[model samples]
Every structure is written in structure tokens, then in C-alpha cells.
Target: MGSSARLRLYMNDNGPLILDGGLATELEAQGAKLQGDPLWSARLLHTNPQAIRDAHHRFLLSGADVITTATYQASITGFIDHLDVSCERARELLMSGVHLAKETAETFVCDARPAGQRCPLVAGSVGPYGAFLHNGSEYTGAYAQEMSIEEFKVWHRPQIDCLAAAGADLLAFETIPSIKEAEALIELLREFPNSQAWLSFSCKDGTCISDGSSFSEAVQMANRCTQLVAVGVNCCSPALVEPLLQSARSLLSPDMSWVVYPNSGEDWDSEQGWLTSEKTSASISELGHTWMKQGAALIGGCCRIGPAHIAELRRELKGSCTSPSSAV
Candidate 1:
């Protein structure tokens, strides 16, 4: 089976997968100064890999069934410029993002998985083209108008290639802000026939994505992709989840699962990635059941969300998200 099918098996047997909260959130709390860094958390992949691993370990202990890599702001060019390395070396750094997450997940599963439970998944994150721009255009997608489809593909292919080649269980094409960019990504996804990915958008409201395209239209596009394991929104306000999912209900494919992980309520900064916000960490767990009821097969938090929130989320979902064990 392809990677997408691997995820389906887990969801089929284990119910909705519990995704991890923010990597940068944990990193910042650990005293890694991230403000004004163009590479964001990806910089740590080179300077302090153990920190990333430790963050993943905490989320795993908190009951995250899936952990995302710190590649959201990573790109070949960015790494080359920042690290002053050869192109090949830059690729290695990019691939290391997957390696670090995979290693951490493997360690967790070995120590924690009971007889019947499936192993937790490591999702290699592929952030939008705007993320590389370092201007927060990911929230607006204004850059899509400046690049051709081929240009967009050229920009994203390397990161996706590195992550897939590095052995992530699935790729997460997340925080996409425009329909055109989504179109490019969906087309690019077909090239890696054996690889599976989940596509998520950054919405401006309940009705449409950030670039003003209808959310329903984006959902239709996502479900048509043969390699997409799930589809929904991420990095937007938690309040938008219901309206976005409800609007897509009529057109959603039953075979296509929903994956929704929103930010903890804050404005996104281009340079900082996420503005410091006062989030009620408990609110994510408080609202998780409603998202599941709305047809989400996978749920978790985004920016500003941390291990405590994930523990609460797991607690709230304890009845359905039991400790993974084959004995069950």
C-alpha cells in the first residue's frame, strides 16, 4: 500500500489521529530566541537538533498520535544563504527535518505502543511558497499572483522531495492561502505516486480561503487528488472550523478524511511566524469534539498551541482515543 493507505489503516483501526501542537511554540518556551529569524524554527535543525527531538518527545508523551517536522519555513535557498553551505549540504539539512521527527517518533513508539496500537505518524510539513518569502504572505497568498504555476512548483518541489525521500509517513501541505497555489501543489503531489499528503488551507473566514476563494471549491480540488490522505484547514482561527467544514459538507467525498488544526487565536507575523497571543490553552480541547462531530477524522492545535493543550485534548478525547494497543 501507498503512504496514504498507511495513514488510513491507522485511522481505520485507531479512530481520529491526534496531531501535535506547534514546534516553534515549544522551542520558544525553551528559550530559543526566534524573533526576526528568517528561517524560523528550521534554523534549529542545524544548530540544536536535540531541542526539536525533546519537543517531539513531550508531545508524544502528551498523546499526540502524529508529530509534524520543523520544516514550515525551510527551503533549499534559505538554508544555503543562512548556513553558507553547498547545494548538496543544504539538501541534507532540509532532509534532516524529516530525519529528526522520524527518529523521535520511532523512539516514542518503541517505548510506548501497546500490542494492538499502531505507531504514531511523522508528517513532513511543506509550508506555502509565501512562507519562504519571509513576509507573511502565506496568510494572504498575494505572491501567487506574482508567480506562474511552474514557478510555484519549482519553488516547492525540493522541500517536498527532500521530506518524502527522508521517509516521512505523510507530507502535510499546509497553510495554503490561495486557490492557484493549491492547484499547483495538487498537481505536484501526483508526481510522487507512492507518497501521500494532506492538504490544508489558511482561511480568511468561514466561507472562503485567505485569497478570497470559496472554501468549498478548495475542498473539491483537494479531494480529487489521488495522493491526498485528508483535507481541511490549519493555522487559521479555531472559530472558523465549523463554518468552513459545514460549507464543504455537500461536496465532500466520504472517502476523503478531514484534518483540522487551527492556531490558538493570534495574528500571524511574516517574520515571527506567529504573534504572541494570550490563548486559553484549554480551549482547544474544549472545542475538539465539535470538530470531530463535523466530520474531522484527525484533529489538533497549531500556532501557540503546546504540550499542555495536547494533553488536555487527549484527555477530552480519552474515550475515543484510547492508548493504541493491538489488544483493544
Candidate 2:
């Protein structure tokens, strides 16, 4: 098979669909300072569009087949948290992130493709609601009259609608900690025409989300999507997701793919109050290949892992695969 065959397999099958994660936040951490930006805390708005595009380009070079738009923090939850901005403006920024990714891929990847391909398809990333539950969980229950589900519908509908309209190849909902949030997201995605969506859980351990729903239950619910193309895990430590895959494999249909985009084992400290960083390219690559073996057909990086890690993943994958077309 040729390049087209491999690309087609990546596009259609339950094999590794490598994605690059954490551009805006990672970029800021890498010292791309954006002072005075009201959205500085939001990362997506604080980071320069070119910088975000450049990060996507870097990921592609590192062998990422898919590059997600830096739209996670562009949402209402993110914007309000970072800048105290209105929901509408935040939604606009979210849509803008999608558009920027589209534009960037067209400019950078189209010319870089082997021959006939125009651009790398962009995955639109939707993050969970920023507000943590009183119990330190993220999945909230029935909305209050002030911020009811009905209100969220009005706030989030625009972002979901715009991402669909922007021709995002897939909807990648990341780090969802609640069953209610996942169901709501699936409902929202159903309203978008021609968009394929995937739901990912944020598990601190391999078994359950932060809110205590078992990973098995989460996968069962996510499989309910009428337009779901695939589902898996992201944002938690890599060590935790391997066994989770084993438990879910029996439930997942062969045609429906599984993804694993883990963080660098880093977390926010409680008493010290700082980011704990423990990601490495070698570790990420090793774990990525391990994830692939453990039933993660789609492998990639998340928080604290960047293009370098993605590149290493591609290198390792090329070395392991039998496909000649996988050669960079």
C-alpha cells in the first residue's frame, strides 16, 4: 500500500490516529508570554494565533496525523474563568480557534503533504465546564435556575453550532468528568449536522472519573452517540489508562476505535500550589506504543506533552508497524 492507503486507514479504521495536544497552555509554559491579555489566564485567547498554528505545524512534523484546534479554553467556561468575559464573546473565540486551525492547516500542511492532499483535518476540542463541584469533582448535576441546563444550552449551543459549521472533521470532547456532562455533550453534538463526535473521560485512576463513575460506564454511555466515530481517555496520567483499556475492550465494537491521550503525570499541587511536571518524550513514546498494544488504536499526547513527544511517538510507531507507507 502507498501513502493514500495508510492515510485512508488512519482516517477510517480503529488504528492509531495520532493527535497533538496542549498548545496554548504548553506554549505559555514554554515562555511565550502574553502580558496584559485579559484572556491570559485562558491560554487560548492569551496565546497568539500564529503561535497556536505553529504548534499545530510542529505536531504534524512530529508525525501527528491529527492536530486539534486550540479551542478548549476559548469556550465560555474558560473565558469567564480567565478574563471574566461574557459567554457570547468566549463562544466567538472558540469558533475563531476552529477557523484559525483551518486556515493554518491550509497554509502549512497542504503544501507539505506527499502529493494530492489539501490539508490536515482539524479536530475541534471542547473541554468540560470549568467549575468544580463542591466535592472537588467536575461533573455537576441538575443546573440551578441561575445556571441551569437550559442556560448552558443557550451558552454552549453557539460554540457547538459554530464548530460544526466551520467544517471540523471531528468533535473531540476532552476531560469530561461527569456522566451528565458527557450525555449533555452528546446531545449537543447530535444537533450539529454532519459532525462526528468522540467523548473522553478524565480518570485519575484507571477505573473511574474524578467524580467516581467507572470507566466502563463512561464508555458504555459514550457508545450511544449516533454520530460517534470513536471514544477514549485523555488528561490523566499515562500509567493509569492502560488497565482501563483492558476492562473496556470487550464492550467496544471492533469498528469503533479507542484513543488514549495522557498527560505527563503532572498535576496541581495541593499544599505547595504549583504545577507538577513529569512528562518526557521517551516515556510518552514508550507509553504510547504500550497504549497501542493495550487496545488504544488512537495514540497521542495531552497536557505537558508537545510536538517533541508527538514526533517521538511517530518515530516509534514507524519502527514498530509493518506498513511501509508509515515511513516519514
Candidate 3:
């Protein structure tokens, strides 16, 4: 079955499917050094693939319905420049990210998981063009102003092609910062009609996307694409999730689901790293409840949100839903 079909089936049986938290965060907790590496967790695909697999395993064990691959910062150009590998080798490394997640999911089903628990789906991570630049542009969306739509398509095409060919259940065009990139991605989806994807953006506020576009407009753009099964926000503040979902709910069609996976109520600085906020009020579980109430169909965490947070979300969501066992 196709990814959209599988996701629909899962939602029919379960309430809202739980996505895994930050793979890089979990990897770091496990002592994988990612700093100074432009590829971030993608570097583990080559240096320590087992670490990547182990991170996926932890999220699955924590009750995530979907586990994304470690290909978020990976691209052919980036790989060739950083690792000095040929295009073939770069593609192999990109495919390895999906393979690792798939293999881990299979192992969890066959060996570790309890009876009746379903195998988690694997989503190939496709971070924004800004991520490839190794700058903070992903959070700001300023880079999109300089790049044309055709340039965006050209840059993203190979990465999308690589993930689709690798047999990922779906593509996660996550942390998107602009409507132009989202448009480019929606167009690129036509190149792989059999594949389905979820376009989640990085927001500047509750009502606006990272590039200052309204959330309603971004959601409306994604709603027109049949290949996109879900659309909403990720890697933004958890506090913005409620209003963002409200905006998305207003524009999204009933056929399309909304996904929200925000950070752990912390601000990120490129130099200082993640800065905690004493002023932040809502907990991750509380944000999950609000997101569901606002009509989100898929919920999880992003940066600084680890397996423990996912486990808590699983418990919270399962407890609130009518069919708790259906989630597994």
C-alpha cells in the first residue's frame, strides 16, 4: 500500500499517530558527537550507522507510530563537498539512512515489541535548502528571497528522488521556512506519483510561517496537492502550535491531516545552543492536548524533545483516545 493509504488505515484504527522526536537529540544523548559537523546527525550515516539505528530503536520502543530517517541534513552536493565522495557514494549514504530506519523498525517488530504493537513507518527526512547551507537560514527563511522557484526545484529534486527510490514510506519535507519551497516540493511530488509526503513548516509565530507568509496561505497551498497527506508545522515553538493548528484547520481540507512537532519550549542560538526559558509555561504534554483540540491529526516533538517526551505524549494521547490499544 502507499504511504497515504497506510496512514489513513492507521488513523482509522488509532486516534492520532505519534511521530518520533528528534533523532539528533537522541543520538547526542547516546554520546554521538555532532557539533562542528555540517551534516549533523546525517554524519552518523557514514561514521556510526549503528548509532542512528539505535536512536530509531529508542523512539520505536517509546511508542512512536512513525520514525523518520537521519537524512535531514543530507544531500548529494553536501555529501560530495564534505566527504569528497562521488555522486554514487553520496546516494548510497543517503539511501543508508532509510535502510537503517527500516531495518530498525523490522527488528523492533520481530524481536523487541510486545504483541499487537504495529511496526512504525519510516519517513525519509528532507530538510530545507537552508539546512544544506549549514546556516541558521532554516529558522529565518531569509534564503528563499534570493533563490528562485526553479533553483529551489533543482536543489531539492535529487534529494527527493534519492529518498523516493530508497523505498521510504513517505517523504518528510520538514522544517520548511517558505511558501516557495513548499510550492517547489508540491511540484516535485508529481515526479513520484506513487509517493506521499508531509510538508511541515518552521513558523515565526502562530499565524505566520518562517518567511512571514500566513499559516493559512501555506496550509492552503499544501491542501491543493493530492500527494501531501498531511501539512502543518515543525521545529517551531510549542506555544505557537495551538494558533498554528487553528490557522491550518481553517484552510486544510478534511482529506488532509495536520501535523505539529515543535521544540521543547526552548530557544535555539547558533552559538549558545538551546537556551531554556523560565518564562515558558506549557509542558509538552499540555501542548499535545491543545494541538489535538485544535484538530491536529499527527503530533510529536522536535529539537530538545527526546524519547522520554515521546513516551509521555504516547501515554497522554493513548489515555485520552477511546481506543488506546488501537494506537499500537
- Quick one: best TM-score, which candidate? 3
- List lDDT for all candidates, in order: 0.85, 0.65, 0.86
The lDDT of model 3 is 0.86
Model 3, residue 155: distance off in Å is 0.6
Candidate 3 residues lying further than 4 Å off, grouped into runs, are 2-4, 320-328
Clashes of 1: 6
lDDT of 1 by residue, 242-310 (tens): 889999888888788889999887776544565656753337688788888887888998988998888
- Measured with C-alpha atoms, the lDDT of residue 179 in candidate 2 is 69
Which wins on lDDT, candidate 2 or candidate 3?
3
Higher-lDDT candidate among 1 and 3?
3
* lDDT of each residue in 166-276, candidate 2, tens digit only: 667777887777666777787777677567777787775767776677888888887777577678888777777777887787887655678788877776453443365
Candidate 1 vs candidate 2: the TM-score winner is: 1
Compute the lDDT of residue 186 as modeled in candidate 2: 79
Q: Considering only N, C-alpha and C atoms within 3 Å, which residue pairs clash in candidate 1?
A: 115-326, 116-325, 116-326, 117-324, 117-325, 117-326
Q: Which stretches of candidate 2 lie above 4 Å from their native place?
A: 1-9, 13-15, 33-47, 76-91, 114-118, 131-152, 270-282, 320-328
Question: How well does each candidate superpose onto the true structure, as a TM-score?
Answer: 0.92, 0.79, 0.95
Where does the lowest 10-residue lDDT sum fall in candidate 3?
319-328
**C-alpha RMSD of candidate 1:** 3.1
